[model samples]
Target chain A: MSSGKHYAKGSPKPVLPDDGQLRLFSMRFCPYAHRAHLVLKAKKVPHHTVYINLSEKPEWLVDVSPLLKVPALQLSAEKGQPSLIESLIIAEYLDEKYPQNPLLPKDPLKKAQEKILLERFSGVSSAFYKIFLQSSGLDDFSLALDIFEQELAKRGTPFFGGDKPGYVDYMIWPWLERLPLVEFALKDYKFDAKRFAKIAKLIELLKADDVVKSFYVTPEQHIEFWKSRRAGNANYDLLA
Target chain B: MSSGKHYAKGSPKPVLPDDGQLRLFSMRFCPYAHRAHLVLKAKKVPHHTVYINLSEKPEWLVDVSPLLKVPALQLSAEKGQPSLIESLIIAEYLDEKYPQNPLLPKDPLKKAQEKILLERFSGVSSAFYKIFLQSSGLDDFSLALDIFEQELAKRGTPFFGGDKPGYVDYMIWPWLERLPLVEFALKDYKFDAKRFAKIAKLIELLKADDVVKSFYVTPEQHIEFWKSRRAGNANYDLLA
Candidate 1:
């Protein structure tokens, strides 16, 4: 089975080769999985991506992750070995385990600030869901966007990681990539690029990044996926 | 204004002393705040606690925390400085900054595993809330408890951190401390100590720790606070 195809319940589990390589159980369109994907690419970690059908999960997933969630990283091919779950934890593990491209700052305070920044962005995320998915809370979404704009402005840097797309940038990119779909879906809504210049520039820079490009889904494709999801028949294997 | 007292909306903001010391903004009864409190105590981090009335937050809270949440760690006494929020993030910051008693493992894989374990425990916490707070999800809570018991038994450790309480232990302690309140509130419920012998022992070990003792709220007090909260008038200053 090809890695890009999401393995569903009926599909036979792919045998793990004896060769030592990290395996990431993921769902193609899951933003959480995207977080791990970006980190793996950013850090250039040696890993294999295995897309799983979250709607109809594979039976063998229980062995891979105790949580039975996507974005679980199996450290090795060996059976009975525990796979790490939760996207941020996997990203942090990869960052610490492979120290080539350091995503987090060395200073503990600075590192915490970035983590806090990501935490604060939860506001933006919830508001985004309300506006785009539920078709409500437009004002709240706008407010969240304004706060994000101000945060970007306050940092006074090209990127939140200070001149480089680091932890916060990669973590946030998945959501930013989906913003265009909002405008596409709703006729009344559009993000004011002029107003949120810092974020606007960031979107462009991240879109151009080599790492993001590899896993990047086009806005149209994202819209198509969401449309399918809304219609109650999600196409998890859109790429396939 | 002593650090022990809960400062409310009308209260004037306390001046930051020229002395450079860490300050923690907290709500005495909040479990999340308790996590940071435990970490601070366990690590013996030099800090002063400033209890906040979450119902009616202090006007100056915006200056301390952008999110206006408890467990925000002000790294220094200097004004206009950013305070870190989110309990785990604050705990991690303290562990990194004050490394006398390291809460997290030095090995990246081991550290990630601990974090993953904590993430899994969210099920137990949520189930606890559903059962005790909302009077539902008893079966779910039982299942979560069974999973926890199995996890503890598998590790074969006196504490989640093995011999001593570490990150997962301290992080989960707040909720475990509150479990007795569940049995108290729900007459039909009682944890099977024999069935969950491992967790029962682990809880005993944690409760006896010096650090846990310092911030320990008696089960009676927790019940009182919850009763007050349920009655729509929470007593934030139970100690005061």
Candidate 2:
């Protein structure tokens, strides 16, 4: 599954031509785009990534995405208009259209549970993102992390869905992966990464898996990107 | 459908026992709770409403609803357990168990559309709710209404779905009915209610229909209640 599109370290970037293939317009540093990438990787769905510079969005990118946000996917085939933006909607659409490894459980109750967890994650992430934006004091950061740790503690198993990584895990992991960057931003924040044992274990498990590891990037890169973003030295056009 | 339960004008209140037949702990004014109310009425599902005062939530209410919010529903028939929380989940549960006057459309795409609209309405309502809470002047209110008007304009028909009102309509209409209260609060600020023509027209259409009007209250009363709420004079608990 990984052989066809392997990127050698420092290799020339892959050209994602508009040849009616599935083209994912994304910024590598974005958690949202990373979410889409994870889903495609887990499902083994082939797609071309067009890295959009967030500071200076390309005319074609804006033309394709009304929201002009990264993680915007264009599914162009031999016929019909290319399907456009919104990450969650696109992920669900892909899950429905291509039924390889099911992301959502079949039972309605189980599916509802997954959705609830996703909603909680969204709420938690929003709070954390706000704190990150303001470079708010450590007290707020610790409080937000404590809430997340408490939520992670409620799950029966290591993963949100108990055993196999499901929709909630995919939706949530990207943000969790970016937490180190957040921690770097607020150096005074006192939350120990190990305090969230379930999350730590889940991250370890996911990183160890071959399919998951393919999409994983080091924490150092994440911290560097965010630091540059906060300094206003880096253009964030890809995320716009 | 309206026979069993009567809120007759100028009559002594009926001796409604907390025998708990079915306890719906809700704030009557909440759009989310209104969704449950519309379904219960449509199905004629008999339940006694327990208005949970949000500001000073009783101990039992907190025990029943950890979130300490209204729209919590409990079935007295089932000995003792936690009541169901979250409006959309409760609506689905009712539709599944009762199966009368199904709220959801049968077709998959149509169901998807309802869910999308419901989500959109929620997003819009959340934005407006924030503006209503934090706005010191009319500018914020006008901006929020402008966004709401644009979203309403995107709808192809009077109802979010075509002719008949469905789940999305019930989910959204209650909130729109309450918008005037926000407007009243910003009255001195010179906010223009006339600018929201489409929303006003839709509310009028909803209020005139037999099915919708069955549970509808006068706009003036709705506005008055919500205004009192903003002033912290009225108890929301009485509303459930």
Candidate 3:
């Protein structure tokens, strides 16, 4: 995992030789990057992490990620070697390449079902984004949570991926991890754990999972990060 | 391919027995659904097409597709059987299930690269949507096209998938197919073919490809559909 401060614009470019080791360009507080982190930890993929200052992006990032986004997985450290971007795509690629502790289902239909669940989870994410930006959308977030609760009951599984925290569980984890911080931001926000018993249980289960625990951040820390972001001078190196 | 009008609200529910034959719930004029059509045609996948009215969706669509979106591939005709939604997911599912005439690459890295290209194509799609709605965004569309032109030149492949049109080609074709209609909608928009010579040639190649030819719509026909859509009555049955 990445340690130390984020490399911002004008920071000396780190040496990235073709060492055959995987490198992940990431940001500590980014949920999307967090998704990749969980996948790598779960799979035990050998990779190094490089933090980037998103606000003042470095010039060299475009070589690896044309879109200049985080969670870009560099397969080789060689300059001009293209890196994979998009959290889902990066996770899928890692799973495919590593082929151990598989994140996705092998059966095509079953895999599609898992992906569909993730698609529905987008509603929750949209609501989360709304709340993050404007401190609203709790109603919509609750409605989205209802869908998850129903799906969990129908599946009758411990995790969304069945018995273990797999792709869907991990993909959705980053957002769930920050819910407390979101609740802190909102006035009189109380998550009805009883209504969403299954999801609530799943959240607790994920919190205890080995992979999640290693990369997990506390609600207090998240709130601190949120404060920094809201203050217009995001402290990307809070834990560095 | 479907041969009749779309099923709208108040329409009788079609019998969906537990037949093994694949069914694609699609709309005639939808670009996203058009993507699935091209893939099915290219792969020679034996599938039935059922057109749905977007404005007045049938009640039964919810059973097959929870999201009620087009290009929902029903693996079985049985009621309550879930169908796949989202064009890219459906396409990926089809490719994985069939495993013949593969739309994606075998190498995981290569596949990621192709997928990344598609990610970049989102710029063009966003611009296209702008023009479709307000008859603007030609400049942005051209700028997005420049990226495609560069990528095509860098790859030096006849198509994005090399030698033959594949997933990315088919996925992007729907937008390209409607570009002419977009041009017609604008006052004095002329596509600079020379600037995007490679993409221009690619458009021609895709136009002539057997699968694409089978599902081709002329610029004039697209203009008619656009006119209907702009008038608040989409002519989904134009070809029917």
Candidate 4:
């Protein structure tokens, strides 16, 4: 299954204007945008994704996005109704906006515990992003990955939510999906599954997921896209 | 109004041992810790606070806090009950844990909007913290405050949550409470009340609030504490 429409490098944006029923501004290959994709898939939230050309951003997108980032939801086309930015907020919004299949636990303590996990997981997210973005991972990176794997083991839950994937699972799943890309690029940084059995199991569970299968791209594809991004022109079809 | 039990500089650790009731590990001057305090106060939650000396962070705090940060709540003294860190998470937990009075908006959209505000507000919080911590006012620091003020104005509410202070109010109030100290320290970086009238009014309202008044500290007191912390001592009398 296609994650969303791809506005590949050197391609023109769709000329058809938005019809205004909950549209997500996204870039097909963006991990952050992919987060929104996973949440929508998990919650089965009905929405459309309009892939933006990051290299050559449309003027309108700049108006909607305060920071010019993807995964911005155009709340309403009405005048002065500002778009919502940030992936986690957007994900939780979708969960709240549509209650059909709740991703978040209704119990407050459980929810807070999950939020704490998301906060702690930021270290892992930063490390994953930095290794590729700054090309430096010799420090403040490995320690975070260690904490994550240890926490997963300590929890003894197959998934962060246990038995079935829940808020915590969906929140971090996108990044775990992209870890292989990091390993492929940095020879020293390898994902040792045996060392991190629980994470490995979680990753395996996520890959076999129907929603994950729809947009799963291998490390080579991710690496291809990264090369294009590094060379100044992105939107390469890693999954093509 | 007392915020919580303070472990003053050079003071002995409390003689009373841990009893299972919810206990907050906090630092009086820390804005993040203050957020948790505000939530507990707002919800009228019956919990105890144990102010930690961040400078000399006790071994027990380090043991429980993975990041060695305060605002850690000991949910239980049981062997494996990992302490919860992060103020927003703690604040939300208190809201969920004790449901006497709900601090969060019932509506999901409202909650998401509040969270988006929190995410955006981080810029302001960072700038405020950095100007004091690094002793610099140059760069993205001021722009964030401007956006915050502008957003407050755009909302057109006396408080972020109309009619009364809500989740957004408590989450960001701690930082706002410290703005005066920022202004006192950085002569050039002042909070122009006329420009940020909504915030100004919010500040006044918060000051008059019974709960806020109880823990309110003077800018002079904050400056004194800052001088100690800056000189690497800390534990000055903000409450006194």
Candidate number achieving the greatest lDDT relative to the actual structure? 3
Instruction: Give the CA lDDT, 0 to 100, for residue A162 in model 3.
Output: 90
Winner on lDDT (2 vs 4):
4
lDDT of 1 by residue, A1-240 (tens): 255999888888888675678898999889899999999999887777789988888888887876688889898844566688888898888899889989999888888888877877787778777766778876777677787688889989888887889999999899899997678657887888898898999999888999999889999999998888888889998988
**Model 2, span B70-174: residue lDDT tens:** 687776666564467678877766775677777787543345445644555545576567657775434554555565466567765776545666676677777
DockQ of each: 0.92, 0.21, 0.84, 0.72
**Chain A TM-score of each model, in the order shown?**
0.95, 0.82, 0.95, 0.86
Arrange candidates by lDDT, highest first: which order? 3, 1, 4, 2
Q: What fraction of the correct interface contacts does each predicted structure contain?
A: 1.00, 0.04, 0.79, 0.89
Best by DockQ: 1
**lDDT (Cα, tens digit) per residue for candidate 3, span A88-193:** 9999988898899998999888898888889888889899989878989988999998998999899999998899988999999999999897688686887789
Location of the lowest summed lDDT over 10 successive residues in candidate 1 chain A: A75-84
Query: Each prediction's Cα lDDT score?
Result: 0.85, 0.65, 0.87, 0.74
Q: TM-score of chain B, per candidate?
A: 0.95, 0.74, 0.95, 0.86
Evaluated against the true chain A, what TM-score does chain A of model 4 have?
0.86
Q: Taking chain A of candidate 1, what TM-score results?
A: 0.95
Off-target runs (Cα >4 Å) in candidate 2 are: A1-22, A75-86, A137-155, A188-194, A235-240, B1-23, B39-48, B74-127, B130-156, B188-198, B237-240
Candidate 2, CAPRI quality class derived from DockQ: incorrect
10 residues in a row with least lDDT, candidate 1 chain B: B73-82
Worst 10 residues of 4 chain B by lDDT: B1-10
